[model samples]
Target: MSITAATGVPVIEPASVPVLELKGIGKQFGAIRALHGVDLTVRAGEVIGLMGDNGAGKSTLVRIIAGNFPPSQGTIRFDGREVHFHRPVDSRAVGIEVVYQDLALANNLTAAANVFLGRELKRSFGPIRLLDHRAMETRALELFQELRSETRPHDLVKDMSGGQRQAVAIARTRLSNAKLVMMDEPTAAISVRQVEQVLGLIHRLKEQGIAVMLISHRMPDIFAVCDRVVVMRRGEKRADKPIAESSPEEVTALITGAKEAA
Candidate 1:
């Protein structure tokens, strides 16, 4: 059922048509099976928490969706159309952006520069083109403001804190006009205040109608923002339920393999 988001926007219902769907997805690394017969679906404006213990194949599943590699078996549907994603660019071309825990920002680059790293704006005059630093800075400032980030756009990434680094990585999605944003361990190491800000940003993203797949170990984060929770254990999906229908202890049990399936 639909509900109002934190920002007063309509939240997508769990039964809505999915923005991305994985059917019988599987992955194998020679003799090692990384994933086995997994099924998942994410709808627009929905935040899904992909939860699991270590070695549960969460990374393999996300990598497949991010187009880091081809799935060994199964089909992927994007916006209701079947698609094969063979490369990272293939995923990016379709508005799927992943922000890993590394943040992946250039240490010496300014936040604005990092935001527009490879996708910088250019101004040309008779074949004489130059990077539009001012435009990028302005755009970055606006994006940061939207996320309620206090970090300055001109500050070097090396000087930014964990939350700011995460913010910068997320801002890149805005530059790419992302439709589905997947974050891995967004609040793994950060101050409590910073975590609050980052969580707020996730809510803002939902208000903007962007689908989010949050892979965080923080149960509070999942409870705080996720509309649905999908749990994986031993390379298999154990649970997939609406957040409203499950308790924190129940999800924990599912993750720890105390519960068989959802």
Candidate 2:
């Protein structure tokens, strides 16, 4: 029920303070309502699977959380404090990191560059400032080592495999010391070996007490790591339960809106 951090930090589960909580989360575009009354809770050191069919409002909800736009009809609570995300910067400032399927790495940049991205370290020389590449690379290597990844810090993202790119993307979150990471379809298109690596990386994140929101259609991926699942259908949350008490069949039925028949 409790896990220690990667550096042996005693991780408090945030039992009284969930990392993120949503209530009556709704989104509307013109006359079309994309989401209605959606509720979700993400706890520290836990991996939560967000499963829903296409057109099920999963994307809408994620965008809202990522600060793509403000929710039209709900409240967001982070670390027991009420908050509003009007822009992506606001979300990032609060240690909320979202890694989409694209990985979002600059293809031409080195893994270390991408890890720091906009928040690069600088060295000063008589009022002149330059990027401290060596420091960034060293830090990047340390992060990868902590994740038990074999990725090279100086390697170009374009040259890396899909799984390797994902590793770098996930490492970027650690640069900001993120508390919660939302992975959108993490294992969509990758080799079997790559999938295993990414799944192992998720376990590492959880061990470090970083809450994870894993949004994937792959049942095996969900079952492999998720502690709980929230199933959505037609823009509304249909079921939320612990992994131990819920089966893939039950989740599938809830997602497909076939619960009654099943």
Candidate 3:
């Protein structure tokens, strides 16, 4: 099936049997239609890049997948089964975690505390509930080591570098056994060095057999880490193709809705 972007929309190819599939997905807000007949699929062990210009419905789509908003019309399927996600918690229960561009981290909290923020370990002492600080710290350190992350569990998030904070976020998601991680412009606010580190982390995520949906406008990064590219335009899917099959120029044309001469 093909997804065409409207007026200013891009044209992207479609993938096969995505681990996550949105069939004829759509969302409407009063008189404004945010999305229409959009279909998408993400497969395991693949980094699918979702590219689009501003107002291209990328955020809307991510929100829908992340369960921030339910689609007004369409069916969402995960692992070949139809599923309804009413909230972010529902998405998490199904192993879908989203890391927004903001890299939501509590600056005042230590790395360990930030990583295990909501799901902290606890101990029971004869009717008294106690936070298991030691256990949490130990597991946080272990998780960092497993990811080859250099940040210390005791490091204050405010004192850590941008990349370090990013690492903490990713580690937290992994700790929750996330099967699919959606990163929105993960490299947006970091230094060049940190961008490299994040790219390496993305590759590592795939190696661990976790599917990733990366939303970025950086063509080089897309070509570098993503196995396939899915472009969106004007609230619609434009193209979804293997990285090797399409060139940067071709993809750009798709995004801008510039048709090639016959």
Candidate 4:
């Protein structure tokens, strides 16, 4: 920890540990070996940029971590304990959340509805129970405010911009108190302004001490928000370096095989 010279205020690093650890993680679909000996660790509040070319096993590794499938070999340790996840729920049960590119939102629904889609708030009236619209709207409003987003709770998702949709999706993760969030192609095809908003939201998550794994092909987005960059090529990790020590040129080379490994 260091103190500011001018203000004499102490700066404390956020306490962190390896929230997710993958050791010798591998996968195979029949005879096709999709991943081999891939090891990774994401600590609390760390933002990792995962970049690679198409068919570079990025998706396969993410799917394995997301519990879409079990690894063919190796073990996954979450919060310092070994875990074997058979399905997505098992991962979610342990505070893992994924925000896919599609956002998986109900277009016709309000932002509040989308935020609490599967985990809706309920109100009981003696023998009757109903969806708690007022409570949900109140909570969703608070979440949007926490993210510093202008998205209104009652606004229909279809009428919202790409960035607002992202806000709602991220709010859901916050609602779940997710320890780690893996976002797949979050900034893809979004406008420049919207991209900035999404990056700001990522910063907010970091400030709140949530680990984020951002999977994207966009180099600027990675450099702008990530603390570290992990590169993969042909189903193997090629580089894992601090973002300050790795340039886009180096990452591009690692992805395309111009440079072997780092």
Candidate 5:
């Protein structure tokens, strides 16, 4: 299926096969089991918020999905094909982009340079080719404008505000043609206004038909943008329900394993 935007751009819906699927996933560290029998599905154009307290296996699960760690047992499928992401680059190859809590921007690099950090466009000059700074800056500006962000390509990362920095990180993800964008506590240290800006960017990602997996503990943030919420407790999925069908209190209880199905 496909959706047409108000601007008449045809946004292709995620394939019938989920963009990302984890079935009976399990991960262990030494004698400790970080995650066990956890299953997740992320579809195109939908935002799924993952909620759990610290040590609830949110980090382990994300690491497994992002290819930072391999699962001990389970099957992961992307776009209908079984995939084993042995490294971060492997994950990126399949259009899976992860934005960690740190936002990973180079403090000294300009916004455009950071956006194309490792994937720089270069003019062909055999082995002596130089970086195409002009092209990168132009493209970065276009992407920011497309997302309706106000940040400029020439801005220094260290000089920008929190929200602007977040926008730049998100723009970098878009540059990779990411089909699934996973955000880990994207609004953690920002001001209220910055939080709003980041949330708006999440919506824009959905508008572009990208599948988003959001990891956050903030109930208001989750409820504001997520179509569905998945609660995890003791490294297991406790419940998956539509945001509107569940109350914050009920979800919190589920996360803490304080309530069972009535």
Candidate 6:
């Protein structure tokens, strides 16, 4: 704690606060309700696995958090301050980043080019500015090294494997110093070794005090990296607990509605 300048009162550091918090979150689309009474909390350096079947409101909830849309009713607090996001940029401005299932990379571009796609570095010698390829490649190399990935900065993304592509996307997030990262099915169609690579990257993010929310249907992936599991069914949250206290069988039952909320 630190003393406040004016009142001389102690102030708690932000490290003690939760990174993301949702209270009574709900969403509706016309006559249909996509989510209802969902509450969640994520702390720094924690990984949460969000699992559910189709139409379980998983996508809807993610969209809301990503600022694709706003919740019909709820309070979203980030770093202990309530915020309302009207657009995706708003969320990104607050250190929230999302990596969709597609991995959204320009296959025609090199790893370094892709990493600096929209926010490319530039240098000026007079009135003209040129793209700083060397600087970008150097920074991209550093990011790949930080993640312990073997991806080469100058390699074409189209020639890279699924795991390497993931590294490029994740490297972009690192460039933003993102506080929360929401990953959608990162290991969907990768080889066993590649899956391990991705999981290792997740571990690296946690080690750096970044909060991760992994949305995946693969049981093993979730069990492998998540500190806690949250299951959604029929637009409502069915279970939220530590990974050790829950089993795959129980989660399956929850998703299928064979068992009620736990």
Give the per-residue lDDT of model 3 (tens digit) for 1-262.
3445566556665555567888999999898888999988788898999898899899999999999989999999987889998999998988899998887899999999999998999999999999999998999998788777788989999998778888899989987889899998998868999888888888878988899999998888999999989888888888888999988998888788893310
Task: Tell me how many clashing residue pairs each candidate has.
Answer: 0, 0, 7, 0, 0, 0
Over 4 Å off in model 1, which ranges?
Answer: 1-16
The lDDT per prediction is 0.92, 0.91, 0.87, 0.94, 0.90, 0.95
Predicted candidate 6, C-alpha RMSD? 3.5
Please give the distance, in angstroms, between residue 147's alpha carbon in candidate 5 and its true position after superposition: 1.2
In terms of lDDT, the poorest run of 10 residues in model 3 is 1-10
List model 5 lDDT by residue over 1-262, tens digit each.
Answer: 5556667777867547788889999988999998999888888999999998899898889888899979999999998899998999999999999988898899999999989988999998877999999999999999899778989999999998888888899999988799999999999978999999899999999999999999998999999999999988888888888898988999888877788531
Per-candidate TM-score against the hidden true structure? 0.92, 0.92, 0.90, 0.94, 0.92, 0.94
Q: Per-residue alpha-carbon lDDT of model 2 for 69-177, expressed as tens digits?
A: 9998999999999999999989999989999998878999999999999899999999999999999999999999999998999999999988899999999999989
Task: Give the alpha carbon lDDT tens digit for every residue of 163-209 in model 1.
Answer: 88988999989988898999999999899988988888899899989
Any runs in candidate 5 off by more than 4 Å, and if so which?
1-15, 125-127
Candidate 4 residue-wise lDDT, 1-262, digit = tens: 8898999999997655599999999888899988999999999999999999998999998888888999999999999899999999999989999999999999999999999999999989999999999999999999999999999999999999889999999999988799999999999888999999999999999999999999999999999999999999989999999999999999988998999998
Error of 4 at 82 (Å): 0.8
lDDT: which is higher, 1 or 3?
1
Q: After superposition, how far is residue 129 of candidate 5 from its true place, in Å?
A: 1.2
lDDT per residue (tens digit) for residues 1-262 in model 6: 8998999999887667899999999999999999999999999999999999999999999999999999999999999999999999999999999999998899999999999989999999899999999999999999999999999999999999888999999999998999999999999999999999999999999999999999999999999999999999989999999999999999999999999988
Q: Once superposed on the true structure, which residue ranges of model 3 sit more than 4 Å away at CA?
A: 1-18, 260-262
- Candidate 2: stretches off by over 4 Å: 1-14, 260-262
**lDDT-superior candidate, 4 or 5:** 4
Candidate 4 or 3, higher TM-score: 4
Model 1 alpha-carbon miss at residue 14, Å: 14
